[model samples]
Target: MTGLGTLDAWVGRTIGVGWLPTRRDLDAYQLRCLNETIGKARVESPFYRSLAGWPETSHLDELKDIDRFPLTTADDLARGDPSLIALPLRDAVRLVTIPTSGTSGRQKRLFFTEADIEATVAYFEHGMATLVRPGSCVAIAFPAERPDSVGDLLMRGLDRMGAIPVALPVDGPVEALVAALRELQPAAIAGMPVTLGAAARCMAADGGPPLRIETALVSADSVSPSFRTALAVIWGTEVFEHWGMTETGYGGALGCDAHDGLHVRETDLHIEIVDADTGRVLPDGSEGEIVITTLRRRGLPLLRYRTGDSGSIAESPCRCGSVLRRLRLAGRIGEPVALGDGKRLRPEVIDDAIFAVTGVIDFLVEFRSGRHMVVGLVTSDPRTVDEVRSVLRSHPAIGPALRAAGIDIAVEIAVDPPPPPCRKRRVLGVEHVA
Candidate 1:
């Protein structure tokens, strides 16, 4: 079993007692926090107070009683209601506005106080300890220049852990990132999966001495198995996956050395899996849309918030022997685009097949009309274009879907397409031919 570097102990200390908190201990603590959060939300937030059928805090006798609360959807947040904020505007230290994908110009705004950000920093400090040693030098590829940015918070966490942090821009040219890695040769790296995968392939193409990096933390996007395999094969580093978003304060769950599944930050947040259609909470091990409720967040307490991400909670204990619950993520909940013959194009499936190609660095996917898929590639070797096409044709999911829809695949090798506006990658939808 792999060591999690005082992580289990820290969780225990935060929740119940020492490092070995039991399920019962966790349930008790969560119930207390839930009641407190509900009471505060009802009294302070106009949105919560305005809800039609909110029950009194006393109704929540146990953690499962959380189902009594109505689910809060992304539309609720995007409504731009100031009433959603439980605290005064002056009390908020940070405000994050995220444009809802697939929605026309709709945005969800989240507010965070200093305490909320500190909670994230604390979580990062402990979770990252699982990957890096005290004196390790880590390269951060996520945005870091701004105050209260995810990378800046990660840097602070590393500082607390006695590790050195190097800021590498995620949006910068791949050549620049490769050069920085060659110069610093940091012991560990952290970034979105695609950006890190590109850097790894670029560095490998240079054909010099191998980087001494031992571990990596990939987040902010759904990590495909092929990306992990490629990173390990190219960089000779163990990849740890992290699951979080801006709404969760950027630190929700982190994988330990065991790598079976990610361990949730139970002390800070309560996670539930609910059926997407019925809004009914599902049992552990049942895959459904992820629902989250903040147990301790103060700035804006989200009660039974429906996060559109699909995932499940592990029924069994972690092999690493941590009392924290394990979360197995299954990417986004719904299909954004539909193909004919009851088939949908999942970008994650395509990502798996495409990144598995050896010379591929990155690619942009476009779903055009007439059931056609266009892939624009940035590859280390020109020959990879043909190989990528072959891989996609032979892929189990992509092949069948395309064949069923009578979709023809087109490949265009490019020098470099413009970086995505955000860190997460998705398949673009185009209505007409150019």
Candidate 2:
């Protein structure tokens, strides 16, 4: 068996097997569950039943046959139609309302049963075990005020592993979180990328004893290369990236020790990469939009749900030798702002360069009419402000994108504390004004 706490055994246990499952066993189990989920959705979900062009009760002969079903989008859920629920509203223990700008202010409400929530907790327990030792303290920096929130579920999982789980306010002041972590001296920390990076920079400036943090689980947003390097270099901790959304019950793929890619929670989700323009499924190692299908979810089973995130299935086998497939995320899709010269500016490109500068905490990018851009930066040290402006001006990606688009950029720096982390970070593009 492979070391480094690979999820192979946990997967076997999830699929009700005593040992690790071979490729054939995993596929067979997925096919069976897929058929069951389809059958259940057909009967219990009004959305599935009313959806056109799909067989009412037909069982998928193979996993590839899923292409026959039509795709589900955020708009479908954003409609707030009760037909999306696979079970009665009363049965749902937790209801998550996600307000999306793309939805014209209509919120996407998700229903989760007690069983569904517990499944996520199970994934968290086994997944987090790889990062933290038993009896170690874990500072959960995500939201945990409500029951069954990602943080609460994480806390429950860490508790199961005999690890002490401490909740740090994700929306509160970064200084407070840094102080709490310093006092707690946690073994592992889990939260969003920007939040963790901001706090790490603050800790580095404090100039105290090195934090004993062993691992960091950064999730709820894309993890930048610079952010990972910052955490590793500053705290001497392994940074693990996690990819998931409320649609996937908040637990999807997670990075193993190899750090090459994230090992997916295949027991619950069957992820596929598909072309954004056409709904065609792409081959392995091909970057495209992420599509998800729930395997065991009962309250609200999703079928071919388009996540609008760009990623690919890793072509190379994991060094950890886990039987599960790995997902290599390429961040969110459609994030590029078109410039006047038909060139495009990628927020991630700017993010990577901005965060590479030391003492930089968090930054916001505002693009106007493809002609001008304002980079609002919050830095721990005022001295780093000049360094950031120089870096952005000289960055290869930023310069070309700006010149080709004929866009002028102004760097604005502030030493004041940054606001709480937003739901998702991206370029704030304004309409091109005449």
Candidate 3:
């Protein structure tokens, strides 16, 4: 196994493309990657061997037919044997398995080889290169478990770059985290938007330390622009949003220096925007589900995996000079709140409205049906209900859409808040509360 320092140097030297390759260059690279990936998948993975047919040596264009290759879904893994690893079980240097949080009913078991871990760390290094400079102290507020988890991997990467990393675990009491932040006084912070928002509130109440956070990296859930603005005001820093799934290693896209949208890592992965209803590809700038093909994954590879995210693409080159496609993620496709009308409401819109209400501590929105939604605001403010109603009524899209859907507005402002000490407080569109 390579030392962390050596791996960091190699990543810093050759991970990301300095300049965006031309269309011809990208095409050639894609074809080469496709050939190599298909060859390996066919030879090593039994799941793919039965699904993906052999490719001809001369006709490379046949790879464009995605239908020829069977789609691999989370369900496929649920039914298969766990020992069906692509590489020999003994040769696997390091094995790390983390059951997903189970956002869906079924939990996904993720297997990572030592090489997969290294690749993930390298990806983070490449992504951070756009924002992090040497010697920057990064305060990580994600799940920091012992041995090796995603959070541990991030800490290792930051250390390799000579940046101080403060791992503030989100599992324990919030007061403990507050104390740790005061002691560490990091230059940058990274975590889910909800965690960062709570930390920002703590900082606001305590008149936080004098240190200024230069950049804030947010991930793990959909982030609203209002939440980002609030966090920036509290921390006196810029928030950089990142998008990735547990299955796709760690992160697939990063917010460029422009900060307008996420620049897809074209060199490491291929991205496709397809209509959520039909799998047909959509033109650039159209909102659709995201499908990704991993170019360099050796362990638990994914081919055209449905990400279930709704976002659009920015066709032009980013102001940062990277030609990689930039994505504007709206929200999860299956989770969108359906109005009584044909139209649907994005979760971000509700987040904006919820944050606008003053004296609201924590809240959850439940769509009882297309016609009604219950808003639970955790605040003692007597005027919280009226304020929420006023804001919802004023919004042109929200009000009109709800009216068209025949949704009778039901607002419940609770004086007693729900149990705290959880990672995220706001659970939007929750069908049931455990």
Candidate 4:
């Protein structure tokens, strides 16, 4: 695996990386890849045929101005445009569907070719190396029983590394998950944060079977500070975070031992942080919506695809020894509420306010007209609501922030199984009240 062979191993060679691109080499490679994708889309994909902001085929300099490209939103994919698909259905090896948060909205569909799946597996082969040593058994809690499921691809990668993966998809109750945990004491586990958080709570409450797990890889949602602390204390393991979406064909970025930020898959994708409203690319370290361009994707080559999740790029290099940049994720852009005084209250603020109180499973800070907040909660006991209210009231800034803006909050804790697993419950969300 020397020189070009190593390069071939890195990219699997449809795009052909002759060498590991550095600073300007990175830009050149991305530009070359982007142009090729654009050219292909113009011919095959119906969507990019009429799609705007394509730079002149020969002029690579124009690629620097990516703002010229149209922003692909969740709505774009939801509409089920035939033109978005670059290849015929026969060419695809896998397809994934993502349902949006709202009750009634179009589900996003993603198509992956064999090469795409290989790319993902290769990424996991390298990514999981950060957490588990070779031959270590890991309880893969992700739903991988299906074809090309994240779990399957990860398992394939683990096989390459000699890791024994207990491929368990999170499909049942927390008790079932706990039962599996008791049976197979795998060294590590990776899955959705909400699902895993619920399992953690269940195990902690029941004093359930303690496994020899060393790490929990939580992805999709940002882990609240209190929840992370609880998992660390109860499970006695380091909690590593992952950031990815359906459009990313699953895994996009992963954290290193330093845990400063998630190392971006820079060679395969180009990520940008832009002001949500203006579509202006923010400087590194400035929080904004994450937009990505698939530098080497063949299926649905999304140009400047706007992912509604909010986060920023690290301004400095990571101690992880990789030159690839990292992303610092905040909550979803839609999760924050704007006040009459132009003040914005992030959901994290309320998370600290409520989770500060004990016996709380989860909560949703829904906002109504007149800046009113309905605190929907799931708690263990009678003391939960009052304790939650007390914590918010005790917060010097929360009280003043709400009072100055004429906002009122009402708390409601459910006695029954509120809605679903506590993890699916939002700590802060906005709902329009007519």
Candidate 5:
């Protein structure tokens, strides 16, 4: 049986107690797991074998050599053949299908074995230890009945730690979820920040029972710091952020107790930040596209896969004592825009400038183009809508990025009633007809 207590203790000790692995030790283990998984893929999967010259050695000549492998992108998998299905169907126990947000593509089905599900549950057990008390409960806003879904896996993890887990069917109304939460009064809540934020709004409006939630885990979307603070204020608890995708078996990385950058599951995966255009690896602290290699994945293993999230890696020692590094995922990959004056705009940089404004309690950025770029913002304050626009207009990057993109952009602000929920699209893009 997987030992939840032991893993939880080790992780806690790693962070604060004592005796964590050294950098050298972690590297050796990563190399070993990488080699083992690669050997399996080459032997059992035609997709890997079809590579013109798959590395045959047991060891990587240089870590940078990983970039030489072709990136497994969304288009590649959407058009993939049966041969790319790495594991035998007999051994595969679960399947997860995700639709591409691209303008066009079929849903991609990911296969996993029982071991994969177990691995995910084990990670959650340790990760959730930061929030779950042995006798308490976890309120999940996602579906838990689906076979091997993230909610189900989390329930198993919490169960192993002697905590109860409850959820309303995902498709069910949020009001039902709010009522159940009021009844269960779980010690921790897990859901998208927006979903929780929306639920908090419903509770505030309906004057419901106190949830008594101690902490929360927010995932499945990007949120601004102000937005997170707003969510926390409604629920009266700290929100711990999580960043992951279905491709990573929904268990890539999570924030530690310190609530700094997220600590990647470096033991089971290797992460890299690469220049989006050149695909060259960037040094720590440089913002770029995120590339991931699964060290322990069995069915449908991914190597040098582009995750399409914009983020940076920080190797500096964290506030926590653990040796593991952190990833600062800013948001999803952005589109290119040419400024009316011929300077290319940096969308993420604009994101920084807009979010940095003092009164932007929580906001959504909307862009519709014409001769110039027109920017629309939704903010928390309904009374000072124009003032919010003034703050953004005075930003250093917004004007320059807009002017450089050669698009005639205008800034509009609206004072909305509350924080944006998970269902709120942070960025809404419209094609420029001109």
Candidate 6:
């Protein structure tokens, strides 16, 4: 049995070598993982046994003949009792829980054991090794909800690596955060793209402290390239992006130094890109839903869980020497707005349009009906509404698609306002019908 230190050492070595495993190695590892996971599910989880319809199977190869076990939805977890836990309550060493994004109706609860926490820490440490050097000072800009939240995990990892951790909690007024940044003066920063962008704009206008940030890591939401460029200009640093979800224990993939695409943690988990409607696996470089199977979780494990995000896998290895398979997340599958003419438009299209407008701070897109959509934008200047409308009308995707769909675009612009603090904020869509 590998302990936490052993796991950390393995992650460090694997990441140093670019975190890529050969296809043969991947296949063998997957077989072993499938066997262990299937055996555990059949013996411990009555829900899984009923769902899989084969409680007596001794090996996963038998279940592989059936379509990969159906994805475990947030709804399923929320509707079930806590007795669904596969392990004894007394044996669980650690508990890390987070509220879902609530983009869906209700938020689901997630539980992580000590081993699960160790695995998550190992994955993050490995991912950060690609961008962050040891002993670098890291300033985090995220919600400060609990002592054992993701922010705490990041701080602990940085501490273990001998780096200074500066936490700038974003649950308060923007002015207070600006004051803290002036005091900390950390080397690196991490936060949601929207919050970080807003902070950058504030510094640019208020003439605050000189932000000598070397790298800015953005996650917890989809970020547009234009937004990345804007933040880079504000902070005078390169912006890095990461993708993950709560069900995967807040672990997903990381972008390479090239900044072209994200490399999946194939050794830690198996990724399957499947068609959203058909649930059939798609070829590489084709967009579909991202489904993940955890290979290394001991407590509160998930098998073939649907992430509700849309992305494609890159066929070739990155030039950065990482052997892990790369994935390009287009946007969330649930963020698409359905039109009256049976067509759907992704939020990325709208995001790209809004971000193209100069001086735009933060924005939200609301889908009121099949024919009406509103864009609420925060900006420093008052002329932002017209600028936003022009950009939206000029976009090849949003403008032409909306015109063809016979829907009108409405733009609402306002000065910067503080956003409510929450674990997950949906800046893209509010009240999506489809």
Top of the candidates by TM-score: 1
TM-score of the candidate numbered 4? Answer: 0.83
Root-mean-square deviation of every model:
2.4, 2.4, 5.2, 4.4, 5.4, 4.6
* Predicted candidate 1 versus true structure: per-residue lDDT over 255-332, tens digit per residue: 888887888888788999999999999999999999999989877888888888988999988878787888998888
Put down candidate 2 lDDT per residue, 1-434, tens digits, no spaces.
12334477888877877888777778988999999999999888989888888865468999998888889999899885647888778999998998775728888889899899989998998888888788999999888888898889999998997899999867767778888888999889998887888888878887766686888888954677898899988888788888899999999998888888888899999988999999899999999999999999988899999998889999877898887889998877776666755566666778889889987877888887657778788765777767887787788878877777677777777446455483556667754211
Candidate 5's TM-score reads 0.79
Prediction-by-prediction clash tally: 0, 0, 2, 1, 21, 1
Model 1 is weakest, by summed lDDT over 10 consecutive residues, at 425-434
Total backbone collisions, model 6:
1
Best of the two (2, 3) by TM-score: 2
lDDT of each: 0.83, 0.83, 0.66, 0.71, 0.67, 0.68
Residue range 169-188, candidate 6, lDDT tens digits = 58776667777887888778
Task: For candidate 6, report its TM-score.
Answer: 0.85
Candidate 3: tens digits of C-alpha lDDT, residues 1-434: 11123222333344343333554556566677766776676678777666534434422474365434545556555545533357666655555443433455555555667777787787776566556676888889877676566678778878777788888857654446667777887888888776666556555555446446778878744677667777667668787888887666777777865777886665557777787777777888998888877777666666777776778888776776554568888777676465634577766787777775545545677776445767876555658787887788778778888777777677786545443333434445533211
> Evaluated with lDDT, which candidate comes out highest?
1
Q: Which stretches of candidate 1 lie over 4 Å from their true place?
A: 56-58, 419-422, 430-434
Candidate 4 residue lDDT tens string, 356-423: 56566556676677577777766557677777777776687777777778888788875444423423
TM-score versus the correct structure, for each prediction: 0.95, 0.94, 0.82, 0.83, 0.79, 0.85
Instruction: lDDT winner between 3 and 4, please give it.
Output: 4
Candidate 1 vs candidate 5, lDDT winner: 1
Please report the TM-score between candidate 3 and the true structure.
Answer: 0.82
